[model samples]
Target: MYICICNAVKESDIRDAVGAGVSCFKTLSKNLSLCTDCGSCGKKAKQAFHRALAESGASSNVVSIDAMSTAPVRRIQSTIKVSASATHHQKCIKTIL
Candidate 1:
């Protein structure tokens, strides 16, 4: 779904950005020009950011995907492992919700 009409930003773009380690509104704004124009998409952007963070199994609310990509192999593996586990839990909760 489209999040920022002014910038042509979509929910998928936000998810990809989050997977790429954009964890904050500022970084999202800088990278995707999310809320820069009319600032109406800020709330949705934040929601998407948080949802992506939860899905990614990132411990920090302010993770940087660029940094994660550069991290050691073991760390990356662990992140993937955690993300898998979280995905299962999320599915269950989603079904319930």
Candidate 2:
């Protein structure tokens, strides 16, 4: 399913981004160039973002997708990496984001 027609961002890409710790639409837009043009895909992009978060088992309460959009990208990425590392239990996992 294509989430962003302007950027050609697919649902799977959004999910991968979520798995990599992207929790906000803004970060998604910055990283993937989604919803950056025309703004028609904002709603769909947000939906995809939330859906990805849910599927990834991440708590939406911890980081509001709407609020996190305004945060600095580096800060959000670092925080997400830290949290993911802390919660992930498996060994031999070398990378998360």
Question: Candidate 2: TM-score?
Answer: 0.60
Model 2 off-target regions past 4 Å? 65-97
Candidate 1, residues 2-97, lDDT tens digits: the string is: 989999999899889878865455557788987789999988887786787788876463323443356654453344335634454333333322
Candidate 1 residue 16 Cα shift, in angstroms, is 0.5
Candidate 2, residues 5-24, lDDT tens digits: the string is 88788989999988987655
| TM-score per candidate | 0.58, 0.60
Q: What's the lDDT for all of these models?
A: 0.65, 0.65
Error of 1 at 40 (Å): 0.9
Best by TM-score: 2
Which RMSD values do the candidates have, in order?
12.2, 8.8
